[model samples]
Target: MDRTIAVEKELTPVIQYLSEKGYKVESIEFGSDYSKNIDKYDAVVVTGMNKDFLGMQDVVSKIPVIEARGMTAEQVYWQLNTSLKQ
Candidate 1:
């Protein structure tokens, strides 16, 4: 089955790359909307920017949350894939 992923809006390169790889990609920002429907996605890619300031309050899930800070899109993909396998 094609995996669905929620990615941060700023990660355009990552989004495109993942989409090309046949995953259903949805652009998302950390907020009420995402928190409400977090379970729908297999994983989430976050920028990890201002996480402390912005706060992901009350948001919790078993899915992997990839911090795409300095990592390349390929690296992020690898990590995501790896995490899901286990």
Candidate 2:
């Protein structure tokens, strides 16, 4: 399962951990325009601070968006896997 994940630039730990776990991690800005490339990723990880700032909506993507607020990198990884599985 070669999964590609787009993670906010601030989530360095999550990025490194996911990358180490063999997921193709792409670092993205928090408020940058991602709607154009959202379809390319299997999942997206965010800090949860800016919910509507990513310019992405539920209607725009069916991919899972994991919030990394109270969750650790490992938890986020598992969430990604679980979401993808479902």
* lDDT per residue as tens, model 1, 1-86: 48999998999999999998888999877776567678888998989885631245555678888899999999999999998898
Once model 1 is optimally superposed onto the true structure by TM-score, how far is the C-alpha of residue 1 displaced, in angstroms?
Answer: 4.5
**Pairs of residues clashing in candidate 1:** none
Q: TM-scores of all models? A: 0.88, 0.88
The alpha-carbon lDDT assigned to residue 50 of candidate 2 equals 86
What would the per-residue lDDT of candidate 2 be over residues 1-84, giving only the tens digit for each residue?
A: 499999999999999999999999999884546777677889989899987846654436788989999999999989988999
Model 2 bad stretches (over 4 Å): 56-59
Query: For candidate 1, what is the TM-score?
Result: 0.88
**Which one wins on lDDT?**
2
Q: Which ten residues in a row are the worst by lDDT in model 2?
A: 52-61
**Residue 72 miss distance in model 1 (angstroms):** 0.4
Candidate 1 regions off by >4 Å?
52-55
Q: Give the Cα error of residue 64 in candidate 1, in Å.
A: 0.5
